[model samples]
Target: MADIAGRAGVSLATVDRVINRRKGVKERTRQQVLEAALALGFLGADEMARFRDRREANIVFLLPAGTNPYLRDLGDHLRQRVALREEGSPKVRCFFIEGFNAPALAEAIRRNADWADGIAFFAIDHPAVREAVAEVAANGVRLVTVVSDLGHSGCDAYVGHENRSVGRTAGLLIGRFIAERQGAVALVAGSRHYRAHSEREAGFLSIQEEMFPHLRLVGMREGHDDSGQNYRHTIALLDQNPDLRGIYNVGGSSGGVARALAERGRSDVAFIGHGLTKDTRNALVEGVMDAVFHTDPETLIDRAIGAICQPERQVLPMKLEIVFRENLP
Candidate 1:
């Protein structure tokens, strides 16, 4: 047992757990122990091979299917990373359902509960989704909410920023960039159902009312995180409010906002939004977008995986990064 432990780079207790088929040992460590035992002639080759067939843990991601560049990139990055791993590690599967479909999202959560040991996804704050999250967490499944958080829904961790903070930052930047010019500022959101967007909208509104009393806040519009809808909204907002001085998008519709600004020849208007995507990056470089914010996809995924592995560990909110034309990394 000690020889196997030394060979496997594990403690004697772990070797004992693997040898006795105990529940606590991780799959990779268990496999290593079995390999060492086989090398030492303590177990038959066939036996070790048979035991190796068992998988460690199953993790599933239920991401929203959307045209939002940031979310699409995040999902793609996650899929690519998970595909390159060895056989014994946790197997991650990603499924895309329609964005903001409460029933479909709830159903997906419940459907995967029996099989997935850990589940990560974009969260909606609807009651049905909350109930489903509660059920899964109660069953000991680790749950992490990615970009849009629903931590109050009993999710184990949230893998995104404190959205209200992001909003306040946006508000501050937009307000200062326009620099005491008195005109209407408009807000565009991805969806009303997403709590993150709502929180961001609230934060921006609060700061705008508190500090920028000189500016009038036009009513907000929901863009559904779709570029086309966002473009239309921005065009109308600009046409109606010829005095519009700035725009704050509480969602990922930076592309639409930029396009609208260009079409209306309002590039001089201060625009602030989320995601440091190609469109937004170019906008920043060209001075079309005043500022944009983002979080690293790899960091978010790593934080979520840690929470999933430990189950009870506390996962901190992922950091938010603000980008400007001068600091375009």
Candidate 2:
């Protein structure tokens, strides 16, 4: 204890509290002491035995199911990371919810509350979802919102990028890329139910109104994060507004939008979308898509695990990355 305290620049009492999992110690202090103890080999055989004897934590991840490459890749990456964990680590299980509607997501949370020590999900900001999150939290399960957030829903923390900033960046890029600033620009989203999507749309519109006054937002549509739906919507938007100068896709189905633009021989139109998956990468390479905004899924999962296991710890905002054809890795 003395060695740990000295190494961490804290008192012996603080080290004692952290090792015993006692409350009142600030999370940063606790982490410092824990790291010091591990580095100095202060946790002896007895301490290791005590830790091993404690009840195993069960963390459940509720992810969306579909052909959306980003979500699919996130789920796959998390599963692989959890599977590769060494023995004695917490058990991590992932469940995919179909359609990603509020009711289905709510029910999944309710059902998992009985078994999950921690719950993480891509949230829809709806009353039913909030109620479900509150109920799970009341049952003593730690909640972490990932990718999308449910505001004030008793969640312990959020682990994702600043979505509104991502939207504003997209809007600014599209505005600068468009040749004719006076023409109409279209916006496509997955669903208004997702706070991330709505926030992105709001940011995009705000920047367009403030900086690009001549660019008119002619149409907005929900693609449900489905490629087929996005393709259809893009086709309709082009048909209705033949003079459209740009398209901003604030959702997962950028491939569909790229396909639609290609079919209509409208590759000249400024196209901006989210995610850097194979589909979007190919589109960017083929000059069918302009820019893509993305973040590392592996980093997201790491922060989510920290948020779940150490409920008192704070999760820092994820960095948003923009990928272009010239910077393909």
Candidate 3:
């Protein structure tokens, strides 16, 4: 108890009061104590009992499950929070749904409607999905979108990179690297079902057409964020466009692309894309990829937690990091 109090920066009596739900403790102080207990894993039976009696605040996080490091890292952070047990702690849960299946996602949301206090998720652009989110909002549950914006859908706030800006960064990097070469540039994405991928591709192309007119974008290929699809598509694209000089991964399968490039001795291509997962890191180190625009997944999780705790602490804008072999952090 003393160690918990020390870690929580509160007195033992205050900790006891919080654990036992004694009267007169401010909400802020109580929350701090509870969060400390959660982070430190020093929760007690009394805290568990008090948690059961409180109005269970549930925060459900929905994201597409795949091999993408960014998504995996975010999911891992959420899972850690869900593992914590503390009085009055918001019960955090995560759902890994199929790619942009609006009906399926909505059904999950609807089924948990009664208990959900807030929902933080990646935005899906389908009309049914928007309507479902609208239904949740109508029912008074706070909804937040991460890594993709759903501002038009009346979401509480978005916690991610500006998709267009992320794309422009990729464009500038690819364009600057290839210079005025007449070689074709390729864009591989997850799926058009995702707003982020589409927006990124649009932004990348907009810059390519306007500023780097000489750099031809061959076409945007959908990887569905799958390894096998990315590998197969990359091999075929390379074969079809032997003169392709640059590649940009708007989303997904960057690792698979690295493997394909390395196998075919095509590492000379200026590759730029998203995330800094283990595989992406390896690619950068081995010179198979030129650069990566990473939006920190841990920071996204922290922002989600902050929004849940203090809804007024305006969600911070996500940073689009430019990671090259020279500056691989």
Best lDDT goes to which candidate?
Answer: 2
The lDDT for every candidate, in the order shown, is 0.84, 0.85, 0.79
Stretches of candidate 1 exceeding 4 Å from the true structure: 1-55
Where does the lowest 10-residue lDDT sum fall in candidate 2? 21-30
What TM-score, over all chains together, does every model reach? 0.82, 0.83, 0.80
Which is superior by TM-score, 2 or 3?
Answer: 2
Model 3, global lDDT: 0.79
lDDT of 2 by residue, 165-242 (tens): 888998899989984457899999998888999999999999999889898897579998999999999999999998
Superior candidate under lDDT, 1 versus 3 = 1
The candidate, 1 or 3, that scores higher on TM-score is 1
Error of 1 at 54 (Å): 11
Q: Give lDDT: candidate 3, residue 267.
A: 79
Order of candidate numbers by TM-score, starting with the best: 2, 1, 3
Clashes of 1: 0
